[model samples]
Each structure stands twice: as structure tokens, then as C-alpha cells.
Target: MLMETPRLVGAFACLEYSFPFVTMARRWFVTATGIQVRRFVPNDEQGVSALILPIQREEFGIPITAEDQPDLKAIPTFYQIGTGDFWVAVQGDHVVGSIALKDIGSGQAALRKMFVAAPFRGKEFSIAARLLDRLIEESTRKGVTEVFLGTTDKFLAAHRFYEKHGFQEIAKEDLPASFPLIAVDSKFYVLGLNPE
Candidate 1:
């Protein structure tokens, strides 16, 4: 004998006990949601641009365009070379977020291009955290001892997130000589990987 139990079907709390086996069985059925974080490929240029440009320009009111950011136009050559790497978060066929690490040498790298689509943010989705985790794992594997980042004061949420993830705020002048300080970046941070 199988017992029937209510199943949740969305916004409305409707009790559905149509399938008794589905309620009685201890087996779990996992479905693919098509969300993934992966390395950047040449084919992702358009999707990456589509995902990042609006956030930087329209949302934040940054004057820069996608064309002005050469890195977005040449991810493979600019980010995939040496110890540098770039990753994107995708749902189905749409790119939702992106993060990149730039090898500045001296056991250090610069974190850049951290962006998440408006619809895919927050702890429930964890898209930003996944992107950052991927970058940090890759950095450690590549022997990067420190990871530095630069951002504008406008990104208050980003500041809190970075701080929560162990990135200590640092003075701009303290950045590595090789760290590329963009014009819009007024705040800086560094995360030391190696035990010091």
C-alpha cells in the first residue's frame, strides 16, 4: 500500500496527490536546469558582450562601450594566455555572468570583468560566487599567490561581497605594478592565497 502526499506545484499552494508512488518512493529524481559555469571560448564573444555591456553602460551609467573594452573583444587572446583565464555562467544558451583573472606575474593576478545578469543574482542562484570560486581555484592551481581587483565606489554590493569572501580593501597605490588600473576603478582589493 502507498500513501498519497501533497506536492508543491508553484506559486499557489494546491495540494496534489495524483501519484501515490511519487510520494511513497524514497528515490530522488534529478533534473538538469541547464545552468553551468565554464571556460570562455571564441564563440562566446557575442554572448559575453551582450551580458556585460548593458550592466556596465546602461545600468551603472558608465560612459564606456563594449568597443572601448578591448578585453571583451579579445577574450581568448587577452585572457586565455599565460596564467590568465576567463569563465562565463550560462543558462541554456544565454550567457548570464562572467569573471576573469589576469596574470600580472610575481605570483599575483588581477580579477576583472565580474558581472552577473540582473535576473540571476542573489544567494539562491549563487552565480557570482560560482564565477569567483572558479577563478580562485584556477588561480591557486596556476600558483597565483595573490589576487587583486579594482572597482568603482558605485558598486556597494560588490564591496560587501568581496569583503565577505576575504578580499581586503587596499589602497590603489598598493596595487602591483602590473595590475591594470582602469579609469573607472576608484576602489581596490587584494586576496592573498598563500599562507603568509
Candidate 2:
């Protein structure tokens, strides 16, 4: 279910899956904060890269380039298959944030490419939350029972945000085999969509 209100709309949605054992639907939403989150389109790749690569390389001081990640060029094929999709946050004509879910078979997904610009990082913008809200909202609709993610240990704030949003810290060995592993990933998390 998706809930929206007016232009610069308020949004909420809940998605449900059966394979994880006919679980209850979980609802999440984003308040209208003047940031528009939408599905990835052909034209958005450059903007998406412009938003993410710098965050990975400069903000986080990670040693990588756009070529290091093929998904940056093959968004449609890599992230937009089955229940998976990528989303971007637009402020004016520029892309400021991103989040993506990759259907990794079974009832699981790998959350990837979540990044937000420095200016948009906190409660004032909630850009990260908006991108995540969009991803989770779609995950339930596609019947994904659990969402997993990998992050670097350097992202202390990101760790807190993920924990605050219900993702429990998990060991690398505990992640699903299909969950895409990143060389830089030193931390992992999982959010169960169904009740235990």
C-alpha cells in the first residue's frame, strides 16, 4: 500500500510476501520534505553516479572509481530485475541521494548503493530515510522476506541509522550466499520483514 498527499507528496507504503510464511505487512513512510524519490530512469544514471561515486571515494575516503562497480553503468540489468529496483532523490534537477534493492533469489534482497549528499545527511533533509523508505516500501510489494546490506566500518553514523531503522548487526558468515559482497564491506546487517 502507498500513501501520498498532494504535490511534494507525503508517502507511505506496505508490501507483503508469502514465501517467508504469510507474514504481516510492515508499513513505512516519508514525510513531505521537498525531496522527491522516484524510480531509476535511463537518464538518471549519470546523476546517480555523480551522487554516489564521490560519496564512496571522497566523503568516505574509499579507494574506488565508477568503473570499479559495473552496476553503476548497468543499473537496469543489475538492480532492476524481479522485485528489485533503484531509486534516486531529486532536489531541483540534480540527483542528491540513492538506494537500491537487488533480488538475490529466494526471499532475500541485497540493499546497495545507498548514499546521500553531505548537505542532505540529517533530519533536516532525511534524504537517506526517504531513499530507504522507498526501497522497503517496494520490497514488501515484491514479497521479499528479508533485506540485507553491507557497509564499511568507517560509516559509524550509517551503522546507527541502520540500527535505528531495525536492521540488526550480523556477521558476514550469516549473510545469504547470494548477498553481494563488497571488498570494502566490513559490517553487515539484516532486517526481517516477517515476525519471528
Candidate 3:
């Protein structure tokens, strides 16, 4: 008989991963949440964008002019070339979160724009951790040596999350005018994906 437990303190939406090939998908199955890690696809654009946009607005206090176009461009630049890629966290029919590995050469990739929806933010769901795990696996598959990411000073929660995932703070720098926000405060993180 299945037991119904009390509401988990921070239970977020459930993530289920399905891959076309059983073998490839099995290799990256995370037992903790049973989220099977897989490669991102073109159809994930809208779901992934929805998961990330509000966080961007909150962090930078700016708006995305055209959501579909920006995400659409990334399909060819990041996912298609095989140099970099991303993975999405899906539960039922809805996408809860996503993380991308941006190849920056020298066997290095950057973990960019990870976000879980407001309704599903916390440790119990393990969204961030699981996504990073999948990203590291993808980097290893693509022969990437290391990954780096940049965050703003305003995102203390994100900084903490990165730290928990073994990302170390290396530097802080100015934000280019091209970025949506006019703020100059930004922080950088470096993480070695290879296990010791």
C-alpha cells in the first residue's frame, strides 16, 4: 500500500524526465527526484522562457522586449551547434525550470539563466541542484572542461544556491550598458565539473 505523507515543508512541483533512448536517459537518472536528465529541444522554448522571465525582471528590474525571439535565437546559437546546450525540468505538461550550459571555449562552459517558478522555489524540490547535475553531465558528454556563471549583487539567494552547488565566487565587475539594467554591480562564479 502507498502511504500518503504530510505536505513536505517545501514540496514544489514534481519533475519527470523522458528521453527517446532508454540507455542514454538511464545514464543520467537522478534517484533523489527521479528526474531523468535529457537534452533540450526546440519545443521547450515557451516553457523555459516562462520559467525564467519573472526572475530576470525581479533581478534586473527590466522587461524582455520580445520573449519568443530571444529564446528562438538561442536554439541555433546554443543548442544546435553542439558546442553548448540546456536542459529543462518538466512536471506533467508544464515546465518548472531550466538550466543552460553555454560553451565559452577552452573546455569551459557557463551555467546561464537558471530559474524555477515562484510557486516552486525551495530545497525540497531540488530544482537547481538537479538541473546543475544534468548540466555537468552534458558538459562531460560534450568534453567541456569547466563552467562559469555571472550573477548580480542583488541576487543573494542565487549566490547562496551557486555556493551550495560548489560554485566559487571569483570576481565582481561592471555591467555593460547593453545589459537591460543600468547597474554596474555584478559577480562571477567558477566551478569545475570534473569530480575529484
Candidate 4:
């Protein structure tokens, strides 16, 4: 017998996801509501842009545009090269979030393009966490030893989020030479799969 118990709390969506035989990993799965997390498909480019651009430009006050970021125009060639890939979270036809891993060679990769809409940015949704977890898991499986990322100090919430998920703060000098350092990203972080 299967049971479907639904409860509402204030303005938040369903807070409990009952799993009869699921492990902790599955616990982080984007099972909240009808949102589905998956790899980036060709059609997702437009949606990805729409979802990420506003977050970076309007919300974060970054002066970047789609033109400055050529990688967005060529995610397959830029991000899907070697062990790198991009992912998006969607509900119906709308993209709610996006994340990507760029293989920078030397057994290291760079985490990029992590953006979740304001409506979906909280523990209630776990969109950011799921995206980060997915990137880390996939990169590790592809033999990526360490994941490097850069961010501006403006993203205090993002810094906390990354740190909470095992990413350690590192000086810019510690980053690999091949790492694609973003101009706006002043602070840097790294997470090693095989920590020494």
C-alpha cells in the first residue's frame, strides 16, 4: 500500500518527501513539487539564459551580458568538452535554475553558471545544493580531482552555501593556471575529491 500524505505550512510548498526505501543521496534529489533536474539539452540554451541572466545582472548587480560570456552561446563546445557538462532544473517549461562544470584539465574542473531564481532560493527548495551536489558527484566520477570556482564577495549567501557543501576558501594564486577566472569573481574556492 502506498500513502500520499500532503501537508501545507504557511506559504511554503510541501516540506516532507517520504521515501520508503531511499538512501541519503536520493534525499537530496530534486523531488520537491514537480521540479526535475537534468542535463542541458540544446533547447535549454534560451531558457538557461533567461534564468541566469537576470540573477547575475539585476539581482546580483553584475554588469555582465550574454555577449561578454561567449561560453553561454556555446555550452556544448565550452562546457560539454571532455568531462565537463551543464545542468538545469525545470518545472513545466520554465527553467528555475542552472549549473555547470568545465573540465580545465590536469584532473581539475571549474564550477560555473550556478544560478537559481529568487522564488526557488532556499532550503525549502534546495535547488542550489542539488545543483552543486550533482556537479561534484559527476565530476568525481569523471576522475576530476578538484573543483575550483571564483565568485565576487557580493554573493555572501552563495559563499555560505558553497562553504556548507565542503568547498574551502583559497587564494586566487592557488587556482590552476587553466582555471577560467571570471573578472567579477574576486573570491575563490576549491573542493578536492582526494583531500590530502
Candidate 5:
């Protein structure tokens, strides 16, 4: 079903514990259509993993060292356990990508860990732009006045994506220490969803 608040559009279905079944339905829709999109759910565990792992390896190029694999494992778990607002894209039963928005503070949030799998790369920008449009609108409804993100240097594509969607680089000196993982070789950007 679809629900709308002034800030965002939300869609959901209760699949009665049939994740694989729902995945199949999503894939079929993708194969038949040119693109597929949906809100992210905690139940999309496997699809979430599929969407994330390749991005982690490719963007960070962290070798399978003693600490790497477990770190990679920790990410999706963090996403599942930490936040409730996520979005997913699917094509013909395969999950192609995902993005997450997490509340950071009063009237603020963070966009985190966005990725698009190889097969869905070309449409990444448009898909993400549309999703963010919805998410930002929804955030306004939920009382978020701004949203921020920390993105790695390697994600040149993502940096461009953020710019096109109206995010601006935040001066490093002005950033708060409380921004999670913000100091870790990533640039920060902010979008004023409710500009004064």
C-alpha cells in the first residue's frame, strides 16, 4: 500500500514471512519493466547484503585481511539494527541497490551507505534522485529540517549525485564531532530541507 505525508511517500506490504516470495515478485516486476523501486525494509536482509558488499569492496578496495570481512559483515547489521528508514531498488527478483536515511538529531538526519549494483549502474543517478525527492519531502513532514551525509573519496559518482540533488559540501571546520564516522576519510555534505 502507499501512504503519503507532506514530506515523503511510503509504500509497504506484509508478506507474512515470505521474503523469497516477495523477492521473486520484485524481480518479475523488474524484468518486465525498465526499472523497479521500493521502500527499504529490515526483512530485505539478503537483498541488502547483495546491494552492499560489492560497493564496499570496490569503493574501499580493502583486502580480505584479518579485519576486513567482519567489518563488512558489521555494516548491514548496523543498518538493520540502527535505523528504520531505508529504500531499495529491484529488477526482476534481484535487488539492484539501496539507500538509507537515519535520524541524526533534532530536525536533522543522515543519508548513509547508498549503493547500486553493477547491472543497475547506468540509472543510478535518476533512481537515487527520485528516491531522495520522496525522502526529503517525507523528512519535512517528519520534522527534519536538514539532512547530512559522509561519503568516501572513491565515490566520485555519488558525489556528483549529491550535488545534482542540491546537497552542498559542509566546511570541515564547522562540522560537529558527533557526526558518526564523519572523520573517516569521507567528505560531508548537507542539504537544507527546510531552509529559513
Candidate 6:
């Protein structure tokens, strides 16, 4: 049976079963620039992939395939487990950006898969900031005391963006044992959350 629930413009909601096996999709209203950041749903797999993969491979010249990144293939299984969560910034039906937090235990999490499409980036859209804010807010609520992330030095703009948002660069040896360090990760950063 199909069920309807009232949801806030940009809020996430549980899936509603329509035909015993079919799931009804949840929709979020258009925000200021016709974009809304919300939690990942199964239907978002393709959109998320389209938004992230090309940026990682084509734009950055990373010699990697989607297969090498298991998290991208199964976001819910990889990110939604434990305190981890993944989010996507959607402009209408297209996913324009994405960010994920992978809980690494000990009140800590690993930030991953942060990518914004070229058209949606910059100060006007602030898509990256929105995605980061959502992830940080959710992480704080789940008692994640610290968040770590690894990135390639090639991402100079990303480095500046992360630092601008209070992430401090740290050495490889400083990373938590559970932080998943990918082969391409040459630079690392950490953000400490204040319980206050």
C-alpha cells in the first residue's frame, strides 16, 4: 500500500512501499537556487555516480574505476552503517554534489566522497559548504567527536575549501587506524568537533 507523509522542503523521509515490493520515491522541494541537500536514497545511485566519478577520474586524471571505490557502488552498505551517512545536493532531479561521513568509531568519523559539479560550485551556490554543513551537523548529533579526511595534493581548490571550513592539515601517521586511506590520498586533514 502507498503511504504519504508530510516532509519538510529539504528533509529526508523513510521509503514508502507502493505495491508490496515497489518503493515510492521521496521528493524535496526546490531551495533558493533550485537546489536541496538531502540524505541519499537508493534511487540516487546513478545521479551520485554521475556527479562524482567523472570529477575523480576525468577532471583529476585519477587512474581509477568505480569498481576500485566500493563505497560508491554501495553507499548505504558502506556509509550508512554505524554512525556514517551520505548526502547529495540535488538541483531538481540531478545530483550536483555529494559528501559522506564514514564512522570510524571512538567518537570519530572519516569524511569522504566530497565532490561538486563545476556548474554548481563557487560562492554563489556554495554547494560544497551546504553538503559539508549537513554532514557536520549530523556527525555532531551522533556524537562524532572528530572527522578526518584524505585527499590528493592535486585538489588544491579542495584543500583551500577544507581549510576554510576549519579543517587542519595533519600527517599520515596521525590518521586513525580505522580511517580508510585510499591509494591516491597524499594529503590528510582533520576537524575536531567541540561538544559546546
- Each candidate structure's TM-score, on Cα atoms with residue i matched to residue i, is 0.82, 0.81, 0.68, 0.82, 0.68, 0.83
TM-score of 2: 0.81
Model 4 / residue 88 / CA error / Å = 0.5
lDDT of 5 by residue, 32-126 (tens): 25556677554665666645654565446633232433422344444333332666776545556677777666667777757765434565336
Candidate 1 RMSD computed on C-alpha atoms after optimal superposition onto the true structure: 12.2
What lDDT does the true structure give each of the candidates? 0.79, 0.79, 0.59, 0.79, 0.58, 0.82
Which of the two candidates, 3 or 6, achieves a greater lDDT against the reference? Answer: 6
User: Candidates ranked by TM-score, best first?
Assistant: 6, 4, 1, 2, 3, 5
- Measured on C-alpha atoms, candidate 1 has an lDDT of 0.79
On residues 1-196, what C-alpha lDDT tens digit does candidate 4 reach at each position?
1111223334542322234764221112233688878999989887787677767876778998888888888999999989899999887666778999999999999999999866677888898988888887788788889999999999999999989889999999999999998889999999989522
Deviation of model 1 at 108, angstroms:
0.8
lDDT of 3: 0.59
Model 5 alpha-carbon drift over 4 Å, by segment: 1-34, 59-84, 123-125
Candidate 4, pairs of clashing residues? none
Q: 1-196 in candidate 2: lDDT tens per residue?
A: 1111111223543323223334444333433355789998989987787667666765678998777899989999999999899999986555678999999999899999998766566787788988898888889877999999999999999999999999999999999998889899999999988512
Model 6 per-residue lDDT tens digits across residues 1-196:
2222223333332222244677566453334467889999999987777667667876788987777887887999999989899999987777778999998999999999999866566887889999999998998888889999999989999999999999999999999999998999999999999643
Write the number of the candidate with greater lDDT, choosing between 4 and 5.
Answer: 4
Best-to-worst order by lDDT is 6, 4, 2, 1, 3, 5
